[model samples]
Target: MDDITRDLVTLRDYWRYAISRFNKADLSYGHGTSTAGDDAAFLLLDSLDLPIDALDPFLDARLLPSERKLLAERIETRVTTRKPSAYLTGRSYIQGVRFHVDERVIVPRSHIGEILFREYLGELGSSFLPDPMAVESAVDICTGSGCLAVLAAKFFPQAEVDAVDLSGDALEVAKLNLAEHEVEQQVSLHEGDLFAPLAGRTYDLIITNPPYVDHEALDGYPPEYRAEPRLAHDGGVDGLDLVRRILDEAAAHLNPGGGMICEIGSGREILEEEYPHLDFVWLETASSQDAVFWLSAEALGVE
Candidate 1:
């Protein structure tokens, strides 16, 4: 080991080194972290088997020689491979719940997670779906990694969740997570295109974070993003290919007074323009102001 690496005996020292290396490498952040320091902390803390959140307590803790070597190797891989930290660690958390992740699925980083945990889906969510607790059945379409489906189960304890994804590989990862979260009984995994396997099964709430990345945007995504399954990110030419289909078909699958919550990233304006007749209530989260939308069955004109 080099002198600097050898000197990184304490967690604090290694954390500093990780941050410096991550910044110097110009790594893209979007998987689970938005900054180099946060990524470094995740890698460092996870490598040492320390709690990611309780960093202050373990900051001064010193690492053994073996531990330092493993950590150094992980940092080196992160800088050189441009892989997402989640892939490096083989674990990811959404709303404090842990899930297994790999190249088979995209990292769970949806704003809907925040809405589910908060139990209040912003003003628009409240107005569209007044009582989330009353939802008896929920469906999560395009359920990559099943993180959102698991969260929906936890949020709506009274509801049964159906997580649908087309990719068998992606569904396998979701299965692992659903089993890990012990929601297999409540969250059913389906392998089929959106709403195909869900035929004749109506839901009180439908939520999806479908692929909304336009062709141009998909091309611009960093290597870390490209590492994930293309089906999870490609939304066709306008990024609304799936969104358009969902809007047309979702109404038939929603029960009376039911609502749908969908995340479209930056397709809000396009959605409004495409369907000028329908009213979409844009919901805001801590990080985004107009990435997700809420629409009641009535608003969607479901019979």
Candidate 2:
């Protein structure tokens, strides 16, 4: 057990050492895939009543008995159980934003996080929505952890965000995250399949990172994904089962110039084949994640 005091240099070295060992040891079954080291570090910091930013300094110093015990137990758990660090700590970050996550809700790792962080989508359909507060009313359908809804509020300060999810458990996690960011007042939580609870309500923006993983792909999802709620990851046969339904009725829920932003996973190929005549701007992002489409109410045949 390395002594971890308030020394910055030593702390950073120790943290890196632990991270490297965890990575090499394959302590987590989901290791090499998720940020297991970060998870372990977070757990340690949390147990010591220390802040994450203080990690560099603490690792350089010698560890107190309590701290050593805490880390030892955590390391043992990680090495022996192959459990994901997020599940151990019960939280995750997306786009530098902290989001409360757990088995109830899938961890927030969507590529859309990059778009939101870059403010790309905010401008994509800006022409369609001329109102300065056009995004004042937005919906994050199939919102898990309410990360997207919270980001919408953060980006569009005036927006009243609605986050809907079919799973009560998922909603609970989303609620916690929303409240954590102190955006509870700016966001509303609804429990039901997409759009079921919206009724007559309409929004200027509808952003979603819905279940777009096809049944086949879903079945083969890594163990980490399997641990997440199926309702949050399964998108049916072609991966657009729910997406098609959302698009079919989405126009009705969008204000005249409003649009919906959706991440279609690998369904891009399917969407292109199915809606060749429709005009949807497929926004590109880092990596193979290339199926996000923005559609206006008009595009959906909504009058």
- Judging by lDDT against the true structure, name the best candidate: 1
lDDT per residue for candidate 1 within 1-303, as digits (tens), equals: 567667788988888988899888899998778899889888888767677777889889888888888888899999899999889888988766788999999999888888765656445454455476798999999999999998888778899999999999999999898888889899999999999998899999999999999999888888888888889999999899999999999988999888898999898888888899888988888888999988988898876
RMSD of each: 2.1, 4.1
Point out where model 1 deviates above 4 Å.
Answer: 2-5, 120-127
Regions of model 2 farther than 4 Å from truth: 1-59, 120-132
> How accurate locally, in lDDT, is each candidate?
0.87, 0.72
lDDT of 2 by residue, 71-93 (tens): 66666565655555566666666
Please estimate how well model 2 matches the true structure, expressed as its whole-model Cα lDDT: 0.72
